[model samples]
Target: MKWYALLVVLMVGLGLQAQEEKDIVVKRTLHLMGSTFEISVVAPTEEIGYINIDEAVSEIKRIEALISSWDENSETSKINRNAGIQPVKVSRELFLLIERSKKISEITDGAFDISYASMDNIWKYDGTMDKMPTASDVKASIEKIGHQKIILDPDEQTVFLQKEGMRIGFGAIGKGYAADMAKELLISKGVKGGIVNASGDLTTWGTRETGEKWMVGITNPVEKNKIYSWLPVVESSVATSGNYEKYIVFKGEKYSHIIDPRTGYPTKGVTSVSIFSKRAELCDALATAVFIMGRDSGIHLINQLDGVEVVLVDGDNKIHKSAGIVFDTNQYVEK
Candidate 1:
């Protein structure tokens, strides 16, 4: 072969390699964990990107099967069915999750309780809250709600609820947990960059398809359709818990859906709580905790935690951010 001919061939091969290295983002969305889970990946080829995305969706489905309380045959159901009778053996993953949930309950001073599943939905949001219930009835609403009653046996890998009617649910944190696991699975499968956004409980790693950081918009809780601020996530997670649309009005007062497990009363004065953390699980749980804690106490508790930041929307539609919070002003446009 001629020298110039070989040189020309080498240059063409190098150019093709460079083209492959360029960012190509492929995304897919599916309904999982009772929410829309959007998986995005930046890969060299569409085939590779979709392969990893399907893997993530499978992992999420596996998780949902393990922990969904609604599933009559799931381990969670077994545990709930055997409540106050015997400890039901569960997977190590579920055991560890229960431990983490208990820790979160302790950190939030009972503001975050997994036993919230036992609470009766006395405060209806279907415009049926015309009259406030008696104080005693409201107090009785959460009589069975308490996180301290959940006993975890590490040696046996079992979970026990002390009361027969008591139950635990992951409605607040399950989606975020699924998002974190999916992100980890994708990363291990060589997904260079992407996001696992499970209905706003988002966990992101690496850059977007444009080689820029992932930016998330915080919606105005009072004005659900409006985006008031933005946050940039490099290799972290952000979760937003809002009560704008899920609220009830009683006696000329509005109450949010985030009911206090410590008390049966709904959370008042706070519209939404957005949390940023290294794990979506923590962010998801904390967002719920902060909403129940009210504005001042929630801020105080979050300020004490490390690697956690919160943005609160007050009932008046005012935005309040913690000390560690800094809005991404580049995307913020003043109207």
Candidate 2:
């Protein structure tokens, strides 16, 4: 799913009411990478806090310049412009990001693809679609979307798309990548604790200024305002992909905005999927993949990976968690 406008509510448990004498949490919220980002850091003084936050913002902007497809001069745009004609030499950072994206595509069997941009905008969730697209049109929309067609030359630091119109985008993973980069930059600047919340794709390191582990509340997809559970995010990342805010109903059948790249159709059954992992980038990509993978197969895949867990809410409003995730919530349901 292109989560730029997806409604994801991650209730951060920052103790704003009380604080310790020596340390305090400073935060800033702004728009970046076409999404909302909240950057927070532990600092002894407000002056130092804003300075650190500014540094993180600069780092995020730097990443935006490199990865944004909207920017015609970006490496990603350059590669897209050269599709099928020639390989475009890119920086090692972009090359590696694409390489990692392809690896994720392989893992999910194309449930998540950076090449999803090649798809024609046939389905709109903004209540403008009077009817569904024809089957042939839907099928043709995804003809150019295949990560396998993306060629990467490590030694030459280049990327090439085999089809002339083929395109790749980081909409599903860009914010998380930016968050990860911002966190790393903050840590390198001697910040003891912080959080980079790229909308709902968030990562936390160290603890709150109160010296307590960072806690995050998982919002109930059905209830919207209600939180089902709160869990400690100790040095980890969380990403939630939900269809509650953006979806369409046709012929009494609801369709999520998160489409299956393999079929070029909206996913069904699952309403939300939240992933917990060591990196926000992985959590961000896997959340969308798991939502499209559906409940059974998604849970199965998460169980096999060490240090990765899932908490998914189905269309029935029932919550399911992987083996490693233990939380007390009335929404829990077996199977």
Winner by TM-score: 2
Off by over 4 Å in 2: 1-14, 17-21, 221-224, 330-335
RMSD of each: 10.7, 3.0
**TM accuracy, model 2:** 0.94
Worst ten in a row by lDDT for model 2: 1-10
Q: Which residue window of length 10 is worst by lDDT in model 1?
A: 1-10
lDDT per residue (tens digit) for residues 132-175 in model 1 = 77889988878878888899889999999999888899987888
Clashes of each: 0, 0
Clashing pairs for predicted structure model 2, backbone only: none
Indicate the TM-score of model 1: 0.90
Could you give candidate 2's per-residue lDDT for residues 174-246 as a string of tens digits?
8899999999998998999989999889999988887788877766656656666778898999998988678
Candidate 2, after superposition: displacement of residue 294 in Å? Answer: 0.7
